[model samples]
Target chain A: MELYIGGISQGKLTYVCNKKNISKDSDLICDGAGCTMEELLSKPFVNHFHLFIGRLLKEGGAIVTDGAIAPDGPKTDSDRHFLLKPGHAPDPEKIANVLAKDLIAENPSVVIICNEVGCGIVPVDRTDRLYRETVGRCLCRLAEYSQVVERIVCGLGMRLK
Target chain B: MIILITGGSGSGKSEYAENLAVKLGKRDLLYIATMIPRDGESMQRVARHQKRRKSEGFHTLECHTDLKRLPVHGFPTVLLECMSNLLANEMFSEEGIIKTRGNIPVVEEILEGIAYLDRLCEHVIIVSNEVFSDNGSPYAETAGYIKLLGEINCRIAGLASCVYEVVCGIPVCQKGSGIL
Candidate 1:
């Protein structure tokens, strides 16, 4: 896994495109927010890795299986996974662990674009704090599992690992 | 030359900035603290920082809100403690004073203040918290603060001779390779 991280609109996508010479038309590009692990794997390429955390939080802190797909949402798996934006989960750690394993099983490499979010002050709201920590922990897991990690600032890429 | 140092809370950016200030000084260095320790927690934070810098020979200047009219002294090296607090101070004034103004004027004031600081100090080492990266939605006003902080960070990165992101007690130079 190759992880590209930076703030929103900090040019992580542009940097990835230029570096890998990826053509958007040919490559399967999709926003990972509220997307499933299967949906993510279905696509060869992906960005907004931080949104995966959001999706996980939405899924009651777990990545629902193909059979256990969300009911209120579509079961076609066309592009649907979770519901909540940021909610208190049953067990976030278990969710993180399960998805982490699935992500490591991919045959080809995948580029995960994460938004950095742990540098600011702790939010007063409990839900906000949980979301921040969830994203932060997810990024740390991805970073450890990733072969290459880059932090982009102002459209420039810095190799972190 | 300008050096922009950033890090998360408890990431040791202050220590790194202080060391950089000491090394880059051509005259007595100025420590422009932007934080206003109104509450007890903040007051303790300030006291800890002061104790750390006590033997460093810095002439501290507590300029919380207004950086434009900073007493003009040709200090070769000056470290602005942080931009986040400074921005909050300028954005939301003291309680019961006046209605909190819009972000446009606050951003303008901050930009003007920074330019003035740039002119007064030869080597400006700016310290700022990384605010915009959080994943959750902030309050409407807080969201505005995040936007402005990002703009200022981008602008300053262009002007800075060096930029460092300190993480886990290490300084990672993001821009301007030399003179870290």
Candidate 2:
């Protein structure tokens, strides 16, 4: 696996296309913004991988913090009761690890392009904090599994690993 | 020598900076902390940093604002923990924003403070945040803070003999040498 990361609009996708000798609209590419998990696993290149995590979090996949399921909306008695269940709440870090494993297992040779989001000011919203934290952890795992990791700046790739 | 170290939150910039300081300095090492613990979260952060600095042979000094007025002086090597919180404290006064006082601007005041430390210390290792890369906030105050921090980082980098942007516990030298 290979990973390419940078800030928004730093031409990360363009750099990847040039490096891979492929076009932007090539069928080998998949956008995590709207692509399904199957498409992401099948494609050779995945862009906006952080957004996929964001979407999943919004869909109530893994927004857990402190071993408690953070409510995305109004909580009822059943929600409270569910919170009482032992060993049922999912951890964001564990979720990231599972996602990373899935990505590496299903698409071993995939190249990922994700935005650097954990650098900015701490978000006031709990979900935003969880999303960025989860994305950072996921990227860490992917980078560890990746053979080559580069940080993109102004259309230039700086090899980090 | 003025060294500016920058990286994102939880990117291990602090550990990198501390190690660099230990490598560069001879004996007297000063850690100037700028964050003011106003709540539990920030207090936890402060404690985490303190734990990391234990046995690192650093004499810490908490200077939340008015860095120019710091009394202690003459250290062989001085490490300022961060520039973002200091900049925010300077920029955002209780009355919204303080762009200028009399003639000196906020940036200049802060820079002057840095220059004071530079003049006094042999090696000044300044730690700053890489907060400019993310999707920016919609608030005007946030935009203003970002712009100011960008200016400060650029200025410091220009003066710095070494500038490092750390990522994933790895220090990537942006300018100068000796940090490899």
Best candidate per TM-score, number?
2
Per-model lDDT: 0.69, 0.79
Q: On residues B66-150, what C-alpha lDDT tens digit does candidate 1 reach at each position?
A: 6887885868789999988887777776721124444346666777887887887788899987765556355787777788778
Q: After superposing candidate 2, which stretches have Cα over 4 Å from the reference?
A: A9-46, A56-60, A63-110, A118-126, A133-145, A153-156, B26-28, B93-104, B134-140
What would you estimate as the lDDT of candidate 1? 0.69
Q: Write the per-residue lDDT of candidate 2 for residues B27-60, one digit (tens) a residue.
A: 7789999887875546656776787777788889
lDDT, model 1, position B11: 48
Best by lDDT: 2
RMSD to the true structure for each prediction, in A, is: 10.1, 5.6
DockQ of 1: 0.12
For each candidate, give the interface RMSD after superposing the true interface residues on Cα: 7.1, 3.5
Chain A TM-scores of each predicted structure, in the order given, are 0.74, 0.82
Task: Report the lDDT tens digits of candidate 1 across residue range A80-138.
Answer: 33423333223333444455556667523778777776687657754455566556545
